[model samples]
Target chain A: MKQISTRLSMAVHTLCLIAMLPHECTGDFIAGSVNTNPVVIRRIMGMLKKAGLVDVRPGVGGAYLLRSPEEITLLDIYRAVNAAEEEQLFGIHVNSNIKCPVGRNIEGVLQAEFQAAQSAMEQQLSGVALKQLLSQFKE
Target chain B: MKQISTRLSMAVHTLCLIAMLPHECTGDFIAGSVNTNPVVIRRIMGMLKKAGLVDVRPGVGGAYLLRSPEEITLLDIYRAVNAAEEEQLFGIHVNSNIKCPVGRNIEGVLQAEFQAAQSAMEQQLSGVALKQLLSQFKE
Candidate 1:
């Protein structure tokens, strides 16, 4: 309900589709499969392309694979999409001033813990490769 | 910088302070410590109290420990304050109609993966008890 980023999910979904059928995907085709706008697919694909996960040709040309499915982890896609990390999944605590001792140190402590949690999340994603996701593509 | 939810940070900071001292805490006091409004502290405390993490007294009263520091985890605090799962961190993919096959299934697939990742995150947070966080509390 909260904290899980949609961009991360979009990235994984797109990558999995590509990994399932490499060298034959296009932004428009993938967009149709995802029921989203071609422009949106292209945006995500742009990120994937930048991450070296996909190789794309404009206009008549299509998108292809540049990396092995096994080498592409969910974490890879997450980072590729540049998923926003600073935002909390839900609400925030009311802001505090830096002048106070508790407020001064609060950011550092919370950030450290959040970083640890994030690391755990990344590790979990890393455990699932694009190949793994491809295996689930029963379509 | 953009999405750093002050809520989680504030909750952790507030709880850590309460856990540090062997005394009752008030929202006003906690707010003062965090340099924020007491109303915000009260809101957070309200949720914490509901979660059985803290005991709050209304009308000229303060908050006290309902659960031991060692008994609590960051995940517990997160759940208490968030009132929802962490997987929906950045919100779900919008603009895609659920009537479409891909759109309908997209939420399910993304939800599953997000839950898996969230479970892993909770596991990590559960491993780190509030006692540990309190111990790390710097003066």
Candidate 2:
């Protein structure tokens, strides 16, 4: 089974940890929790920071949410990490024969449906906040 | 931009030709319209065959739709071409630390949301029948 990038789930996990245990969330700690390298955590944290979802402390170190968990939607993290593949969730055959009506018009026709489907997924992500997601964690 | 697979679009293109120009839709001819290799068309056509959407002529050669264009939805093509990636549209980090609450629970928590999001996308695709799509083609 092929899924989208694991970066999205990692981003959400990073944020959930930050929200749950703010002071302990250094790159190393988050990495340990995420079961990945600190470099991976740093990279995702870099993306999260660039997206304004989280910010690091000055000398104290470790990262913190820039906004509340309730304010941060999964779509925010999705858009943050997936900036490169923004509107390309569904690929079309690039070089269709121009003389063929179906080939000529498939991309244009499929583009609308692809965009709509992608948006429907994104809309579902938007509806789920980090707060709601974190609430599911065991005590 | 990483799109799912051109196979979905190609599958649609393959079926459209079969529906619109049934007598002329040999694999080579369809490949010409799709602007790809006949091998690629054959592979996709094979998947469509396994999915019961189309059938190749016995001795005559070329393909025809087993079902009417109205009976086949984009979702059907999406599933057919993407059989290997069924229900994995959104990926979660695989190796989260079990000792950590966020790590242990993130996959479970995110699975529901991912499923919902994936379902929403599938639902949209299901709504778009191939008949509806071909109607948008130019005369």
Candidate 3:
């Protein structure tokens, strides 16, 4: 079955938690909130750090969002996680028979459509900011 | 890694081939072009048949498109194949720690965003007719 990366949602969740309470954002704490292994949280945190969306200090450090929730969109989280390859939003069957007319040309045709679809999804994601999501949480 | 269903593309390819050469679309032949097992082609063909997008005969028969290529869209093919669940497109981590405020509410927030993104993708898919795709193939 086709699946979007779980990492994207987890990253957003992690960031939202950090935005909500930045001081207590250790990997262990985030993992507890995310309900995943600290190793998993660290992996995602590593990606977010690389993307400049989050900062992680050395041995004694915790994680924190680099930007305000209001300034961060789901698109930002998505890109930070690097969850899904844009080109792979609709995969082309790799072993298509090139000798077959339809097989030879389907990739080009489908790719254009896939690109459009992916762009639409990204645009939709961009419209939703982390602040909007954070606001949904009850105190 | 996250991936979109290849079945959606394969279904389009299968239909394109059937439309291009209506007479010789046996499961084996389609599988050759798809470069997958005949059973795989049959599986997709079964879904297409259920969707009323294609017809299959009992014995000594093959697959054929039930509608003209112009009448079919990638959205139709996507739905036919049930490519990805709209909710599953952005999976919420099932194990979120309910004790955390953000974790407790994250699913509802992400779900709404995922729904919007899915709608956008579906709308984009609906706009591209299969005939438009088939037109890209060289004779």
Best by DockQ: 2
Please give the lDDT score at residue B127 for candidate 1. Answer: 82
Report the first chain's TM-score for all candidates.
0.80, 0.93, 0.88
Q: Against the hidden reference, what TM-scores do the models get?
A: 0.82, 0.95, 0.91
Candidate 3: what's its TM-score on chain B? Answer: 0.87
Q: List model 3 lDDT by residue over B1-139, tens digit each.
A: 5567788888889999888887788989999999999999999999999999989886876767888888999889889898445535766688688887888888887888899999999999999988888778866
All models, DockQ values? Answer: 0.42, 0.78, 0.70
TM-score of 3: 0.91
| Regions more than 4 Å wrong, model 2 | none
Candidate 1 global CA lDDT score: 0.70
- Tens digit per residue, CA lDDT, model 2, B81-102: 8778456888788878998878
DockQ of 3: 0.70
| DockQ, computed on Cα atoms, for candidate 2 | 0.78
Residue B110 in candidate 1, Cα distance off native in Å:
4.6
| lDDT (Cα, 0-100) at A23 in candidate 3 | 79
